[model samples]
Target: MTGSLQPVLAGVVTALVGFASSFTVVLAGLRAVGATDTQASSGLLAVCVLSGASAVWLGLRHRLPISIAWSTPGAALLVATGPVAGGWPAAVGAFVVSGLLIVAAGLFPPLSRAVAAIPKPIAAAMLAGVLLPLCTAPVRALVEVPALAGPVVLVWLLLHRYARRWAVPGALAVAVVAIALTAPPARPGSAGLWPVLDPTVPSLSLSALVGLAVPLFLVTMAAQNVPGMAVLTGYGYRPPFGSALRVTGLASAVAAPVGGHAVNLAAITAALAAGPDAHPDPDRRWIASVTAGVGLALLGLGAGVATTLVLLSPPVLIEAVAGLALVGALAGALAAALAEPDAREAAVVTFVVTAAGVSLLGVGGAFWGLLAGGLMLLLFRRPRPATAPAPEDGGTVAGAATPRQPGRRPGRRGVPAGR
Candidate 1:
């Protein structure tokens, strides 16, 4: 009984930490892409429930600690991309398309391989570029609203040094207190406390498909799903890649009309459930993930309240917490983007182009950054020279002078080659 309770508690912690740390980012992204307050709330509820459902299903079926989450990086990408040409409906359409693409990648080996074939440096560079602006929000918040943002930053710093896992949640708690003190009080029954689904009729557009859908898909795959598989594998679990993709993709599609962007496997938080900390016996760890799923679904009931608080708080204050949560991600992405010395130049170009936030022909910076980096790599790649034929029997060709030793020179004396 005690052993069973331990995983349940760990699962509770995982759910609370995961939701508190980055839900602000999700709301901000939906708002950025033209979702209204109500829509954003509904979107948040939808994703929490859907992702939790998927996690529970996968954990029970595979008996592995297969955690699932809404694509936080993909949300950041939406914030960076801003509003699409045809407004929120178009963005919804794009979400549907991205979900279908994920399904296709699972079903079609060639499509999955094609996405995987993208150069690592370029992919990491693009993600870093997308994340750069959001990661800077903490400092900006401090400068802009010192009293409100200072306490949040200070708590985050101190807790980060000691209880690293709880740093963001600690900051979020402070931010909430700060908001309650300064923000205007809500009237009785102003915000819904229950989960509600508000659906939109999706409208497709070429611009949204290219600018929003493609980048969203790429970011979710590279930043969330791929790393999630790695995390599970590191814990000695065989991740059901195809099934997971299909589940998440289908969930994303179903939830998009309700404003949820995307759902994928959890990367950072997966460690909490899959690691030994969740359970001493590896076989029983799936219980932690299952409990986490249920806990997350329960948390979805508070989406309306969370959205109300965000709506009332100073935008930068909420952004500061989200930004702090992403700083580690930005650092990891930047490190990966520059890891290969040979690809450094191309990677930098990708980073610069993406970070520029420029749009061309209705396509966003991410796609263009990849194109520019690929071009740079192709254009600058140097071919290896052909090896010279070996001399037969170690004999020199006719009229060829004897080769000098490395320490000997041509000037009739034993001189160093450098000299």
Candidate 2:
């Protein structure tokens, strides 16, 4: 009983930490994309249920700790992209398209390879650019509303210094307290507490497809799915990459009409369930992911409340918390983006264009950033000399034999015979 309970507790913690750490970012992204309060709530609920289901299915089917999550980085991309040409419906359509792209990547190896062939530094630079503004929100909040944001920042700092893992959550708790104290109390029976799916009829637009869908798919694949597989591999689990992508892609498509943006494999939260802390035996760690899936599904029921909290709180305060959660991600992205000296200049171009948040010709900064970076890389990258094929057993160069003395080997120059 104790053995079973340990994994269950770990799973619960995984779900809690995953949800608490970044749900604000999800909401903010949905809002930025023009989702209404109710729509954002529906998006939250849908992703939780879909991601939870994917996690549960993959964990059981593969018997591996395959954790799933909504694409937090993709959400950040949406936040950066802001409203599209056709409003929220177009965004929904873009979500559907991105889901299809993910499914295609899973089904077609060439497509997956094409996506993988994107230079890592350029991808990381684009992500870093998208993350820059959000990561600065905490400082802005500190300056703008010090009284409300001060305690939250202080708690986060203290915990960040000592605990690290609980830093964002600690800050979130204080922010909740501040909200409860300052914000007006909710009237009884004013809002429903149960999860609600407010479906929208998706309408496709060229700009949304190019600017939103493409970038969302790329960001989700590069930042979330890839890192997720790496996390599982690090824990000695060989993730079923194709199957995971298919499952998550299908879930994202199904949930998109109802406001869910995207769902993919979990990266940071994966370590919780896949790690030894969940189980003494590695083989049994799947139970932790399964339990976490159920917990996340259960947590989906509270989306209404979570949405209400966001609607009630000052947006900047919530942004500050979300920003705090993303600082580490930003740092990691920047480091990876600049790691290759040859790619540094191109990466900088990508980062600058993306961080500029400028839109041109109806396309978002992310797409432009990547395009500019790729061009820079192509134009500025130094060409390498062609590698020559290795010699055969006789050490010939390009099938041409070297002249040598009749009694001598290749490296016995000036030596007496039979020495």
Question: Over the stretch 339-405, how does candidate 1's per-residue lDDT look in tens digits?
Answer: 8787889989998998888888777788888789889888885665899954311111011112223
lDDT of 1 at 132: 82
Error of 1 at 109 (Å): 2.5
Q: Any idea what lDDT model 1 has?
A: 0.83
Using all chains and alpha carbons, the TM-scores for the candidates as numbered come to: 0.89, 0.90
- Clashes per candidate (backbone, < 3 Å): 0, 0
For candidate 1, report its TM-score.
Answer: 0.89
Q: Which stretches of candidate 1 lie over 4 Å from their true place?
A: 186-193, 383-419
